[model samples]
Target: MDGVDLGIEPGCIFGLLGPNGAGKTTTLEMIEGLRRPDSGSITYGDHDLVRSPAVARERFGVQLQTSAFFELLRVDETIDLFASFYRHTLSTETLIERFELGEKRKAYVQNLSGGQRQRLAVAVALVNDPEVVFLDEPTAGLDPQARRNVWDSVRQLRAEGRTVVLTTHYMDEAEALCDQLAVMDHGRVLDEGQPQELIERRQPGAFIEVAAEVPITGDLRLPGLERVTHEGPKTVLMTQRLDETLGALAEWAKQEGVPLTGLATRTATLEDVFLQLTGRSLRD
Candidate 1:
């Protein structure tokens, strides 16, 4: 990671938003004391984390992207095992109930479903009852319902007054769950702010999308239109004034005998902000 600096507020869900290989995990590891940086300082309140790694180990809980537990260990046993490592910890029974794993408490790790495993991972992370939590791509592989379940758990952590820091590649997930965010790429922070603030600051306009068959071109004259680009099978028009742009687009399509199939309009999103900053899509 290069020159990445961030300030996480207490009791909020702070996110590191980036694509794969953007150094999100590396940054998390360094702060968590799993990997030491070659330079720079890390601190928690007045404590220098670099000089006092034990402070971080004792005060923070982590849920790694991939967690590996003994396949034969039961759900409750896994939580107990982790709790044994901490000087102060929450009870296994409490964690099991809070994470909604009561039914699976007796089930072996290998028998749990994807969502169950994710819940178990989170449950174990809280065994220490730390003041801060670190979740790395917590919802990366879960289905929609399961993803929402994890989202609820993250919010619950914040409600309990613990600082939650996470990393994610999903634009919607970051926008929905994060109170503050740092947009990172190539090991550097591009911007940092609330989701809507970043969107309004970096991408203040709205977008008009129509079927590619609409025959709209960059040279087309439309009031309030700023730029035009093609994405997949849709033609996107960026406009500062949504009402005037839509009116002009309809009139132009009518005059040119073009059908406006799949017409849609929406405000700028985190995906748009990322593209504008990096000159590429998140998947790129």
Candidate 2:
């Protein structure tokens, strides 16, 4: 992790996005004082974190990828146990309500569902009421509903004026939740900005996806077509002019006697940017 410089703004939900083994967790651990970099500066406001690591422990809240609690402990009891570690902490009752864990407060940690366990994990992180919260892969294994629940909790943290730094491999999660994002790979940051800003910078054109019995040939020329590639059963066309490209594409299909099946059009996304920069999918 050499020369990894970042400026995380106050009160913003900053995201660290990358694939597995990309060092997102290592970076977050360094910032959260769980692991120390051999040499680097981590400054929090006017304080230098490297010089005073204890300051980070007091001011930062952390939720790791797998948050484990005593299986026998009730939800409320788990929160209380973590609260006991901090001199200043939010009330356990408030933490439960904030994370929508009121109904599960009496349930043992082992009995809770995946979403419930995740909510409890977040509740524990907030027990310290720290100014900066770090979450690593907060929504990695949840279903859509559970993932949305986590996203809401994260936004609430930002609304309360706490700086939230999270790491995720999910592109849509990064797009919807992050106020600012850093795209990382191989222990380095490739780009950083708002989600849409990075998408526009890395992949400016719109995407046209079409499914055909016979894939389009490489030498085929279509108006406004910038690039063409295959993804599974679909041929993706990156186009500069949507209308011109669509019309020309339809005509070409008709001339070639090929049916354009499952045709779709949409703007570029963060996944596109990651692929462009790394030549690999985020899931890879």
TM-score of each: 0.96, 0.95
lDDT of 1 by residue, 1-284 (tens): 88988999999999999999999999999889898889999999999988887889888999999888999999999999889889999999999999899999999999999999999999888999989999999999999999999999999999999999999999999999999999999999999999999999999899998894645664789999999888887898999999999999899889888877778999999999999888889987
Q: In angstroms, what RMSD does candidate 2 have relative to the true structure?
A: 1.5
lDDT of 1: 0.92
TM for candidate 2 is 0.95
TM-score of 1: 0.96
Q: Poorest 10 consecutive residues of model 1 by lDDT?
A: 211-220
For candidate 2, write residues 1-284 as lDDT tens digits.
85789999999999999998888999998888778899979999999888887889887898999899999999999999999988999999899988888898899999999989888988889999999999999998999999998999899999999999999999999999999999999999999999999998889899999999887766779888999998888999999899999999899889889987779999999999999999988776
Query: CA lDDT of each candidate?
Result: 0.92, 0.92
Error of 1 at 82 (Å): 0.9
How much is 2 displaced in model 1, in angstroms? 0.7
